[model samples]
Target: MKIEIPYGDSSETVELADRNVEGVLYPNPVRSGDEQQVLRKAIENPINSPKLEEFLNGKKRILLIVNDATRPTPTARIMEIIYPLLKGKDFKILIATGAHRAPTEEEYDFIFGRLYQEIRDRIVVHDAKKSECISIGKTRHGTEMRLNKLVIESDAIIPIGSVEPHYFAGYTGGRKSFLPGVASYDTITANHRLAISQDAQALRLKGNPVAEEMEDAEALFLKLNIFSIMTVLDSNHKTYAAAAGNLRDSFQALIKKADEVFCVPIKRQAEIVVTVATEPTDIDLYQSQKALDNGKYALKDGGIIILVSACRSGIGSQTFLDLLGSEKSCKAVIEKLNREYKLGYHKAGKMAEIGLRSQMWAVTPLDPETIRKAHMRPFRSVSEALAEAFKEKGPDAKVIFIMDGGLTIPRLT
Candidate 1:
């Protein structure tokens, strides 16, 4: 069978032999058609629609923060709802990127299209690294939060992000954009630490530390009078559902859909694995760990793992590269990570150990030296890797394949 997988702006096709081996496929998350309808409905819904009268009633200026991606831009949806409401009031929109690098012109064009240049006068793209931030009061747990003064200075703040299942957060939305995207480094560190807490790891909503951390972040944003509008995209990357109006209500409704669409079952254990990293930064030793986490779950002991990525961007995070440099072996890495780093780091290190034990391979356009440092064998192409794996195994070796494993969801065939 031939399968097509996402590779940046286009798709890459791969083939598999009909040998009764298990296969995993991941469709791009953006669903354009559903996105439009959900955005339209959210705009029209009386209870959820952005209230121009209420917003402009006495407010001097409203600030909006949005996500910038190659596709599935929510700016158009936002403009449709807010345009009528902003007739006589002063308002501006900003892109909240958090610690990630800013979007480029090509990316902006892909995501915002004409809107990128059209909204120049009223839109201000925020650079988290360089922005002049002011210290916000500490959270209840004493996590110092530094936020954009412009966000705090505005009469109202609005956060917009696409909701999807997150690796550690369980799902992403609500106060996420504000806390990590718009928040200062200190705030990010504090909240990130919470992900390792027992509460965050608990699957239950009431006791989940992730949930509690989100609640704390949400309360802080709300106290500052921030309004939130989060989008939930279907498999096709279209807005299938939406939550608007106040922070909590909109997020709660969207969370329900996220749980349904994002939860996929994997029987656990495959003889072969294939993974892709879209964000080149994710291929960086630090961010690349996310890809490892997704790819390792279904991988069997001594199984072959293939990572398909073109990491020309180079490993961007110094801390991550340094950590990898210091640890000689996967076992030592895990021990050091658990002893010195937080729980999330420890968990990641453990995952890395599992991946190392497996027969791992990478096919990339990255420098040979860099790939060497990653401590994985390199293949020239996807086909070459699969061919090699087939030859290395026993005559009756079972084969399994995974595509775009980073955002993968297993389906029952």
Candidate 2:
């Protein structure tokens, strides 16, 4: 069968093996009883009983932190089970949103769904950035991983998140809920920058020093006695497994399942890139720009890459729009930053190198000038971009197509 694939502002149709091998392996499939069973098992486990009831007994303040946006949000059901368990107890629930900024009502609606009102009324949502976070302590690595004062003040800290394959940290959830979701800005930036700088060539789990450092940071958080409750969600964002004992042991078990669901079908490499944009996560230019790293992996040093962002939602952040205002191209922007702001100049340089190293194009409804300022050639449509890419790369060039490049991580079966 022949399929047309988008590559860097253009598309190319390629012939595939006649074998009917499509969607054979599911990453994480949610069975009907999976979530409730996972929750029930965790509740029934004796080890979790003492602590769970302790929080329910209201002796010490309790904080529940959960992922705000990512798919398969177990928000409603998880809270439904938890709030009842801890009702009339001295406990509080707070949404742990990292530096991604707090969500508005609509976003909150999307995040919490039907549970929005119930969760909102009973619990306080802590914005990691603006909230009164305190310097809990520093890791052995000297990274100051602060926490919300309320969380620090709590007798126990329980974090909830969906485990997924992260581009930098290998996986999300676990101690990530306490760090990026609730830690100070410095800690978040430091950890993120560390991951970005390490092994830029292969941004995978193996042999990456940043992932090790992050694990260390995670350990330090646990060593400080930050008890956590971690859950593993299948691709459907439904709970497949839940662990509720010691923070590390519990998280490790869930991490194992997360690895099974998240890190599947590893790929050696690819030559062409295709990316689809999803928002809030892909809201603004800067946020969406992060997705380019995946394309870097898709390319063969000088391969063509295509981005498809309807982005009708408009540029979402003020800072990003301000930066784009004066810069003509990514390279020019970096040079200008070096000559002017001098701050984050290295990041700008690295970003420019990443952008310029690959032949890139975009198909979006965004203004042509805005696309040009991004240092990308704009195409009229997905088909036009694919056609152009095919013309540019030649009919016989090896091509790779990725749907939703920002969120989808490809693995070989």
Tell me, by TM-score, which candidate is best: 1
Cα lDDT tens digits, model 1, 1-413, are 77665554555677776663565655435434555566766745624445635655688878878775522536666665666667667888777776656777676665555565756677676666678777756666777667877887898777777676555565567776776777765566666766544344312357666566667767766557665677866555556677677777777777667655554556556777777766532434455555555666567788887777655355655554455556666667656765666323534453456556786677776666555555567776777777788788744455555554545544332
Candidate 1: where are CA atoms >4 Å away? 5-13, 27-35, 46-53, 70-73, 194-211, 278-289, 339-359, 391-395, 398-400, 411-413
Model 2 residue 183 CA deviation in Å: 1.8
Name the weakest run of 10 consecutive residues (lDDT summed) in model 2. 17-26
lDDT of 2 by residue, 1-413 (tens): 67654333444554544431132123444453567778767755624335665544544676777776533456667666666666666667777766665667777777666877765765666665578877756665577767778777776666766665566566666676776777766667665555434463222455655466556666666544344566776655567777775665675666567656544353444455665555433554444554555555556677667776656345544444444446756667655654543222323444466666776687667788777755677886766775676677666555555544554555554
Clashes of 1: 15
Residue runs of model 2 more than 4 Å from their true location after superposition: 1-33, 46-51, 70-72, 200-213, 223-227, 264-269, 279-281, 289-291, 316-353, 411-413
